[model samples]
Target chain A: MRHGRRRGRLTRVSSTKDKLLDATVETLRTHGIAGVSARTIAATAGVNQALVFYHFGSVDQLLAAACATATAQRVEVFHERFAEVGSLRELLAVGRELHTVERGTGHVAVLAQLLAGAQSDPRLGEATAAALDMWARELETVLDHVLRRTPLAGIADVAGLARAAAAAFIGIELYEGADPQGAGSALDALDQLGAILEAFDDLGPVASRALRAKVRQVTSK
Target chain B: MRHGRRRGRLTRVSSTKDKLLDATVETLRTHGIAGVSARTIAATAGVNQALVFYHFGSVDQLLAAACATATAQRVEVFHERFAEVGSLRELLAVGRELHTVERGTGHVAVLAQLLAGAQSDPRLGEATAAALDMWARELETVLDHVLRRTPLAGIADVAGLARAAAAAFIGIELYEGADPQGAGSALDALDQLGAILEAFDDLGPVASRALRAKVRQVTSK
Candidate 1:
């Protein structure tokens, strides 16, 4: 009987934790950083207010945990989506698709919250930066692979390209958040992608060769 | 006596209003959207708490006003910078300069706030969209002028290119925000800009001619 009671308590505790996380995301989406309060989050989770104190200890810790959860989820999603991209064109396509999915899911806004709060909250900023760095490294590896196979001379500044690509992705989120209907045309996104590709080609033989040499030198070093 | 009292009241009110706006921006930069409050902003501004309510009426209105002020300032700066850009390279140069200024001042973080907050606030969202549209229109005019002067055959997809360019600009902001050290090198921003310019050239002589023809046709019609 005692074992069963303990098992029941454990189940309740786990369920409460899940609720807290889910509530955190929902609150962030609807009310944003300013509106989220421990009381509000607990209310959204349908748990007692005291449960929040029990699970998170404090609101700052709760927010940090939420940011971590969101960051891990985003990194996992990027890894999965990029895995599907094989060619240069396919890579751009995947980038756009992933951009739409992430923005629409409110993940980007959550990220922005972490970013905006980061200056005041050092832990949140560090966590967000770490997540972005991981993604950039992954992208760099993929670009290196693509460069190795292409007829193009050098890797074409993978780090630079990745940073630009990431900016373009986030920029869409910026516009998408402001004007979903307007941004829906996808015209802007495609145009930028085309520009990135053209820029790659513009480097031509000399720039490409230099870039390739640089990539090799850096990777070796 | 009434007139003198009125003048004194008006001066006090205007000063209070200016102080409130300044506080809002500082609070946004330091604490972000979440930390903005009448009490908090008032405290930051070194004014009485009630002055926040007296000047702005509500937190939402205060934020909206702050957004409007910031957007106007940015547009003015961009227009002044790009007014002299006569070629594609010059245009890219302007882009680099604009981003450098934005990053150094952390104005981009303020932009991030509006971008993320727009998800929740329709008024702010519209304001942001309107700001972007203005940017697009200005860039389109510049491209249109260039197309007219050139022996180029196809129409310049100015609107399309502007949208793409804007996306790239935002991308630069995102990349720089996430990776300040990388941004300092500016490899990513420069590479992305090069890509956009190359693509602009590649829209082809045929497309350029068609675009010019279309422009003529539309203007005439």
Candidate 2:
């Protein structure tokens, strides 16, 4: 395998893949999925078209690899930043960080293209969906841990609630990026997250108690 | 100028425009934005090459017009639905209706295209931004009226909250639609909306007190 041929050339092999992924992200950023062609990606990566094929097998495969790389990075960041928050309030703070990086850094742009492409391309859709599910599960674990420590009435519903929260966060991220000026200052994103956390804090004791109990059951078991 | 045309003749005149818009939606739906082209739209619409210009003035204008037409109808539906909801829960029920239709219909396919396109296209970005703002405002009005007597603290924040809520709703709409399974059942969409509203409701005293005060302030002013 080329993996063996490149034993001492680890940097070269990795750089080739990195260059290809970077080029893919740029292509998606500028041209979107439709505008992404093997030739364009090869040109952007400064490699021969054949080299691209050699590394990734095909254009579609190359795109999937690029998207997978981006998705994994986002998941890692989300987990790294959000994994320690022990309460909903703390999680809202995490939301601020995620939203800032997602909108300001062009991460969402790449995801958007990949997501849109996923509509027509099943392989892409499956890969993206799997990444999303992984993110959700990671968050759920955090939620389960928190609820177990502080049982609330609605705790059993924590997984569903967590999924909804994650979905809402992504939605705000997309909307903010789509129209930066109208969405207002970056602080507005934080404020929005604060409002959601505040609302959750306001829940009735019965609901809260139920949440706590349910989450404890799920996580402890 | 052609407003004077009789309904029968109007059909003839507008058919080209309608076809163009329909074609734009179709092109957007199948291929997403990057694949959308004036020539492809023209061919899809079955219009002569020059007619796209005759009807929409430019390709950009054509895309804008199509997006406006697609978004406007939903806005109209939203406006009508809110008029009937007299409380926060009821207002959310109305939101559920809008979400149901938006998710179930093939509208999301085109919407995803418009959103992805908006990332790179300035004109489209402005148009998409404006549409979302309009939806947010409508939601604010509904929340204010429903919580009119409540004590919720953020009347001024109503617009922001409404925007956030709508963003969440829309994010799910677009994401679910683009998924391999396509739209989920209407009950599924409504159930998600219900969970969000339930979370707000659980916030109970805090939400009520803050909202009531905000409502009073707005109504007084």
Candidate 3:
């Protein structure tokens, strides 16, 4: 009896709900929060407007669920990759790679806009916190490995470093939402730093230690 | 006759408009976008709901104007202070001081939410651009002078650096809108860099040149 197949329940909004969630994500990117409403989102989803309240109760809850679903999927995928991170160099490289696709798909803007929206809505605030918590955990895994190679590891708070890195990524993406043209120069600076970091990677462990020694000297003064 | 003071129009929404804008700001802070409406805003402003349409044409336009007005005022204050920045150290110090007050006043989150909302509405989009442009110009002035002091002066692109710094500030503030406690560590890293830069400041031109030479070694490798 436990292994026997059972008929799917008719109560769940699985097929219709999935459509609504997808529509919510797309609407958020194109129209933003103000433009989102039961009528608009239902039209996009090709469903009746009445079903919006019937299925989700309200527009706010629908949008929050969309954000949470999208973010959770991305986090799961990234965490799988993060689990194998071997160095700080590889960590940044992975970031650069993801930035490319996420930007193209509007994922970056969706997350950024949702974060801004989260401040205004309690349901969204809760969803955003869960998303950030997932990211923080993923980053913590990478940072643990990264700080070990650097000379400042002893003084650096590993958890704080992870949080800061996560913050920087979110910050950079949000800034990009406001100014697209300004992005090239900003990305260029980061690329240059990435190249410098790569160079530090090519050097042997002894040289890496010496370089961090220099960083320690600069930071101490 | 032209110089004579004209009697103020009794029907004008100028006083009422200001009151509505102020109410919008408060509503945005406490209720987010979903709570904002002609009814709620008017109730908060203690005015007739129909006046929201009479003065601003739509709620979207009213919110846009409120954001633009708040941003322009903040820009003017910062530009006055930025004009005096001769070094990067002073720039960060001023930023740190302003961050404390802006957070308490909820100005940071207000601007951030409006920015995300801006993406949905064209009028808000235009206003946000103007605000960002003003901030960019102010930052350029400081970066141009600051770049002259360090080794990066010769190698770094002043305009590019200015844009990156501007993007970083926006990004940092936006991130803080979602995560308040996480700010101190991100800011701490910047302060550590600030201290590093201050050391570069204390060194004379000869030492500065030597430091740049040292930087050239690590980066070029």
Candidate 4:
């Protein structure tokens, strides 16, 4: 009887923690970063405000924890898809799909709020950067695999390119809220670049050698 | 004597408005968007808090005016340099220089705060996007001029590319606050792209025709 009761109590506690995390994201989507508070989060979670301090120590801690949890869940969902990416163009296609899904789920709004909050708060900044790093790491792995055989592998900074791609998506996500058409055009422009890259990959060996030489020559200067 | 006194009073009022505008930007620099208020702005300006309402009607209006004024001033300063840009690589060079200057002035921090605030506040969002558009307009003009003879003119969306460039710089600015080295690599990656584009511009006519044909074929599907 005692063991069963202990397991039951642990399950409740874990569920409550999950509730708080969900509440944090919901509040960010609805109220933005400025609306976040102990009372607000507890209210959103339908738990006692004291439970927040008891479970997470402070609001900032809860926010940091929430950021990490939310980002981890989203990243995990996309991991298998990321692993299957075969080319730069395919990677961008996945990015477009991720953008659509994230925007629909309101994750993009939450991320925008967190990133904004990060500007003034060092703790929040670290948490947000850590969250972005999660995406960048996933992209870096794919870039390493896909670009290894391309001419870009010799001249491109794969790690930096990954971050740049991440940043571009982030920027487009926020930019879209204001100018949807412009954002679409930006995505299309990126797709065009991806197509060019794919073409480069399809080049004959002789043409590939000449293109690589030109890229090296231009970049060296 | 009455006309002279009236003129003097008008001068004082205009100067006070200017002071508030300057203070608004300073507050954004030091306190971020959340910290901005009539009290903080007035305190920074060393003036009566009531003057913010008297001059601009409300804090949001004051912020909107400040954003417009500050962005206009900065854009004007760069107008001559942008007009002189002869190639895509030169434009990137000017961008690097502008990034350094903006970072030093703490304008990047201010922009990050406004952009974050924009996510939640439609009023601020409009103001921020308007400010971003000012920069984008300048860039579009340059991109149109520089890419006119290049193959990208037919394949690239110039307006979209301009916004993408602006978004990239904005993303890099905020990303730099968290990961400076990663930001540097991102900028370098863009420089590499610019170099590649410039090299394409230098290609012989036959090679350019072949490249354009390949790009179109790849993009068509």
**Alpha-carbon shift of residue B216 in model 2 (angstroms):** 16
Question: lDDT at A178 for candidate 2?
Answer: 70
Q: What is candidate 1's lDDT per residue for A1-221, written digit by digit as tens? A: 12123344644344677788778878888877767888899999999888888988977778778877766777776786777666665676676677667756777667655555565666666666675566667777677666565534253567766655555555666677776644544444354434344344444455455544544543343
Tens digit of per-residue lDDT, candidate 4, span B1-221 = 12123344644344777888878989887777767899999999999999999989999889888888888878888899999998888999999999999887766567666776677778877888888888889999999999888877766667778888877777777777767787888888787777656656655666667777776775566
Task: Give the chain B TM-score for each candidate.
Answer: 0.72, 0.72, 0.76, 0.87
Residue-wise lDDT of candidate 2 within B97-183, one digit each (tens)? 766676555565576567677766778777777777777778778878765654343443566667777666655655564452323
**RMSD of candidate 4 to true structure, Å:** 4.7
Worst 10 residues of 2 chain A by lDDT: A1-10
Model 4 whole-model lDDT (C-alpha atoms): 0.78
lDDT against the true structure, per candidate, is 0.63, 0.64, 0.67, 0.78
Q: Name the regions of candidate 4 deviating beyond 4 angstroms.
A: A1-14, A204-221, B1-14, B204-207, B217-221
- Native contact recovery (fnat) for each candidate is 0.40, 0.30, 0.39, 0.44
Candidate 1 lDDT score at position B163? 63
Q: Write model 1 residue lDDT over B1-221, tens digit each, in one string.
A: 12123344645344666778767878877777777789888998888989767777778778777777666667777776677777665676676677777766656566666666676788777766776777777777666655454533243455666765675575455445555675444444354444433333445465444434544543232
Clashes of 2: 31
The second chain of candidate 2 has a TM-score of 0.72
Candidate 1 or 3, higher DockQ? Answer: 3
Q: Write the per-residue lDDT of candidate 2 for residues A81-196, one digit (tens) a residue.
A: 77688766577667667766776556666776677677667777776666556666777777676656442423345555555555555566556657765454323533544444
Winner on lDDT between 1 and 2 is 2
lDDT string, candidate 3, B119-177, tens digits: 66667767666666666677777777777856566655445556565555655665565
